[model samples]
Target: MKHIAHFFLFVALQILLMDSLVLYSTGFCFIYVAFLLFLPLGISRVWLLVLGFIVGFTVDIFYDTMGIHAAASVLLAFLRPLVLNLLTPRDGYDSGDAVNIHTMGWRWFLAYTFTLVIVHHTAVFFLETISFQTALYTMVKILLSTLFTALVMVILQLLFFSSKRERMDYR
Candidate 1:
């Protein structure tokens, strides 16, 4: 239920605001990929792919770019577990541990977010470009956009999300 709410919230933010965010008319940040990053760790792969598609498709509808967003998002979702496996802590995670920065700590979350966002942005820009004629341009756009998106995602998490333990620390 909470995931559903977040899905909609991200979709709305992407379609309503982020779509119009054009840096230098070439670099564009797609912050919606953060939605896929923060999904509960134990969710089934099938549902993750489906939800990724739904979020991307919804954003595509508004952005008017057809299925590029859908493709990138699905790829990001598919690659998430692989990233987690590579970066998992030696002690492993508790079942209740989430993928958010507050749960995973800033260092782990930064690595996780950077890896996935690069993959996601690469897919989006390459697919959208679909030509080597401007490959250099596309690569530049992907790099800049990934940095911009990742920075925004980190700031948002730090500002809005308090870990269960942190909330308790307030008392």
Candidate 2:
């Protein structure tokens, strides 16, 4: 139920709002990726890939970009678990753990988001460009957009999500 609402919210936000926002004509914020990034930690990889495709396809429909978003998003989904493993804490994630700032701590969340965002943006820009003619420009766009998207995601998480208190299981 909550995921459904987030799907619509992120798609609408990306298409209606973030689509038009371009900073310095280089930085474009694709806040829609936040939907995929913040999914519950215990979700299956297949579901993550499916959801990533669905969200990216929805955005591609609006943007008319011929599936670039979908490809990049699928790549992001594929890379997510690897990133999570690399960043896993000493005790590892609890079953109910989430990928938000509140649950994962700011450092972990930032590292996770930034790493994924850069990979996603690289795929997006490079696939869209399909040439080395503007390699530098594309790299700039990837970095700047990654920064912009990560910043917006962090701010949104901070503003909207409350800390998740530990749950006690009483037999």
* TM-scores of all predicted structures: 0.92, 0.95
Clash pairs of candidate 1?
Answer: none
The runs of at least 3 residues in candidate 1 whose Cα sits more than 4 Å from the true structure, single-residue gaps closed, are 165-171
Which candidate wins on TM-score? 2
List residue ranges in candidate 2 displaced over 4 A.
Answer: 166-171
What is candidate 2's CA lDDT for residue 14? 96
- TM-score attained by model 1: 0.92
Error of 1 at 12 (Å): 0.8
Question: Candidate 1 at residue 81, lDDT?
Answer: 85
- Please provide the root mean square deviation of candidate 2 (C-alpha atoms, Å): 2.6
Clashing pairs in 2: none
For model 1 the local lDDT of residue 13 reads 83
Question: Candidate 1, residue 53: CA error in Å?
Answer: 0.9
